[model samples]
Target: MKNFIHTFHKKLQLLAAILILSGVLVSFTYEINTSPDPKKDKVLVGVLRYILKNGHYEPKDVNDDFSKAVYTKFIDEMDPVKRYFIKSDIEEFSQYKYKIDDQLKREDLSFYNLVMERFYQRLEESSTYYKEILAQPFDFEKKEQIKMNYDELDFAKNKNELIDSWRKQMKFNVLNRIQVQLEIEEDKVKEDSTYVKRDFATIEIEAREKTLENINDFYERITELDHTDWFSTFVNCMVEQFDPHTTYFAPRIKEQFDINISGKIEGIGARLQEKNDYTKIVELISGGPAWKQGDLEVGDIILKVAQKDEEPVDIVGMRLDDAIKLIKGKKGTEVILTVKKVDNSIQKITIVRDVVELEETFVKSSIAIKDGKKYGIINLPKFYIDFENPDGRNSGSDMEKEIEALKKENIEGLLIDLRNNGGGSLKTAIEIGGLFIDKGPIVQVKYRGNSPSVKKDTDSDMQWDGSLVILVNELSASASEILAAAMQDYKRAVIIGSNQTYGKGTVQNVIPLNKYYNYPDDLGAVKLTIQKFYRINGGSTQLEGVHSDIAMPDKYSYVEIGERDLKNPLAWDKIEKANYEEMDFYKNFDQVVNTSKERISNSEEFTKINEYAIWLKQAQENNSFSLNFEKYIEEEKEHQAEIDRFKDVFKHESNLEFQSPLKELDLVKKDSSLAAKREAWHKNLKKDIYIDEALKVLSELEPKNNKLLAKK
Candidate 1:
């Protein structure tokens, strides 16, 4: 057994912590050796416990309360919809509710064993129930309602009750599909005078059959999960008690987490998912080798995979992860895939594997021209970076290049869209924020009991000092919050969008499990919350994230989707404010904000969005649907009518023209896929009401030409 002890250098500490903390812990690892291994699970539990208790920012006591929380989380996760386990099964499992804490200290697996064995039995029975229910016809005339809120529902009292629940759920599913099919038929008949539409009976039967296939495929995928996968879930349930961000990654999951943080992977760059007994291609990375080949496409099913000049191995009935192993290879290596095309034709497509950078994950800039003044819009998906390779492509460097390109275009203003960016590399956030201002403190970091350390922009150079506006939403978090907060604190940029960003202010560090224990099996690492983030203004973006300078109404405005909505998030606090000089570039920032507010108040589009937000909130709360076909269709018709009122939100187009930079124009023109993506992005920007308002705000500021300071 090789010991994998990962020691972080002093300079790489901040980078490593942010890379793991910013993103969600990814999927489970592929099991190469699929035999029952209880010993590995036991060791993992011990190692995970040790790491959390010692390394966590706020470690909870492993007492009765902790045990109860874990017990509930584990069971809820395993049977979220209350479809598998019954009331009696939960009753039997409740005995370990308090014993789990003691079991963890002793590295006991009794609770996990009992639950898994019961779960498997229940899973098998549920599969049988679904198959039986779907095999027969469903009565659409049945006057009943299925509660969509699964949390409020209870487990079945008996076998018969469970079967009844499955029947009702299955009927609801079939009814939805039938309604959709009927709509398609109605549209087809209107579009073509001679088009023959399917009858009610035919549509109902087809919907049931499709529902059966979907359920069967779902069960097939579920059956592929082994012990390691479930154990990871159980471990995470325990670890999450420390905080929501702290999670466990299985060995393969850890590898994937690294790939996500880096924003690039070496493979064919095609995302695959299992469909019953086949591997279905879901998406092709825009600039990947598979996309460049032009032979492969989405919806293609891989029947077999082969190495260069080698006989193809059938991949039918193979696990998705296993099939991925066969498809992915080193850069410049060839992998031949015998795929069934969407047109039902079979063809062998050979693609040379190469490092595929996910285009959307990196920083991409587009220029919007209005009144002959160019404005730059840089959308940063995440604070991505490759921790293992210091010289690898990162968001910091990419943003720098993008700013330079936009500067060459002589943009009058800039809009940095950090909305929905959940953050990644901490180093990149600092690097990117520095581009907007001269050397100053950007954010503050503090350990559990240590003095707050100020993280600053040591560089004296500024890449962009024009009229800047940051776009954020409730989904923007961590490094996104850091950058926006710094800009807001310095009064260098106008923060616009949601009322407040996603309040994830904690910092986490990934600790490899194999480092502490030399084991043959590749035990995954744990992302532990080791620190908290504080803005330069002293307020921590924990439960209360960076408040927007000009709040806008959107679909998610009334949603509880921030850190405060999450379980056991760290509390918000304040520290000593960092010493930084506020920029006076936008002297009338308040005037610009007031003008935008007035415009928004009078705009019909903003009024519609606000009304839609209220409607969405009501829709989310009303979680019951009628099982009766007539009643269901009636309810859906009302919803469709309400949705129609907001159609202009999606269809609204602005007069501003958007296009790629001069340097990217040639590259995009060469890569048709790239061109299509940019074109789509430009079209969306043209329809963005927020961008239109932002451009107006930019024009109002009329920043001086000498906002850029002299480089030291």
Candidate 2:
């Protein structure tokens, strides 16, 4: 056994060396590019065709260079700085035409080497920057920090120490990855022992030896090697070749997407992410099991999770999915998590598993007042609501209720706040849009089908006939676009905020891999684009998202942060317009628009927005980024100073907090004034900015009409 172990170790070393050598060669050989290369195009097409055919999809024409074109287009859209590759890079990449099989054979080794080099580079860079960043007092004002840690170890501040740390970190990462892959593979083997028939004795012996060798190599490298900085260089080189979205999803990275999307999952109802070696709770969902227990809080690091009557399993450096699987069990099961609090105190807390739901993301309502006029505000955190489960509280229903409430209050206008709404259900969107207008077309959707289908506002009645406004930003997407487009087309509401919508009009269907392959049913699901949606007015909310009527300034102005900015995104096109009529009340839109422009131009808020827009534009143009510690600190301070300028002017309070608009209406004396107030309140109830201006215009028009009536 000892001899065999020695031999295995020797083989692994050889394999590792071969991988590193191949990766170095490949890195130097391939140059990233955008222009057409027939050879590269052919290779891309072949790979895509294979994926399509073998990957459970109908094979399209693989002969064409469509895949390469799509990839190039996608990359061009995503790279804000355009630093990944230049035209020269494309020209260089066009020279290579390697076979897929040959690439696959050395792919693992190449990837490992590339990653190792990248890791080392980042370690050195981070270490140098860390020392500089720590020299200054921590900037407490900025919400985010670029660097998390710094060290000033006098005795161990040498190249060896840095190398050792880097190696240790890499080994930890590699082991975690191997463990996760093994577990997934093992599950597959157990489900169908026939295909994965393993000789247990041989497997056990081989695995034990490999594990020991991995540990030994990791330890030896950390203690012995003179580490070189290579992370940034390697990552840039690799990512440049690959499409922007095709990133390395490390074992701990599963939670990153979860953080951005759902915020909370069923397991303990806590948000988790890897910070250094620890899986820390970024947030605890309110009213969840974790919050109910009152033991966990944001920034608490979870070290282990133990099942009832089982030994506590150390989860540090474990794959996020595996850890989550252990933590999350059947509802009603008890699981105890050993947690390290922010202050470094450790404690064990038992939490009962329950259906943990995120309530904070649900639609909320308020009222905004400007120039002594009330505007109903419906703040939708996300375009979300479970459609599969009928019992779920639909966002559409919630929005309808808010509209009704505003109507009851008799608001002068309404604003639908979808600033950070990252989209949810399409069904809910249709239902919500149905609340505004009488029976008409809401949005048209076209699949890879023969014809397009027009989804209409089929609801029996309208909730409010008042003026409407939609407040959107770059994050407003998918279902949010559906509602916004519907209102825009019908002229039921004026769209406000941001340059354009998120442009994610396409729909994706989650395809279960286990279902497709009749093998051991443990493989995960794949989300694939299945359909695209078009506005009632033929134009697609695709690459070019729906443009806003009244654009507002934002920090992300220059960042191109939208679905259209994503890699491999579909193109924008047009379809047949749906049947719909413009609202008669909004006929005098010219006068309203002019009045709004005049009013907003004089307002402090609008001036601030204009200033912010200019700042963002300037920031985008800034290409000289500093990696030097002192320079970075200076830049950060300058950035903060610029941000602070808007702090005073951005203060707009909710009118709902002061007094109900309903109560205020009761104080009006004269019948004509009371009637005018009612009209203004009704328009405000729709949360429409344009409508508010329109109401003011109407107020001015009313006296003239009264005089005309007296003359008659």
Q: Output the number of the TM-score-best candidate.
A: 1
Using all chains and alpha carbons, the TM-scores for the candidates as numbered come to 0.78, 0.53
Give, for candidate 1, the lowest lDDT window spanning 10 residues: 1-10
What lDDT does candidate 1 reach at residue 275? 44
Instruction: Report the backbone clash tally of model 1.
Output: 0
lDDT tens readout by residue for model 1, 503-552: 98998888899998999988988888999999998999999999998988
Quantify how close model 2 is to the true structure by its C-alpha RMSD in Å. Answer: 17.6
Point out where model 2 deviates above 4 Å. 1-359, 367-375, 388-391, 601-605, 620-649, 652-712
lDDT of 1: 0.79
The whole-model lDDT of each prediction reads: 0.79, 0.53
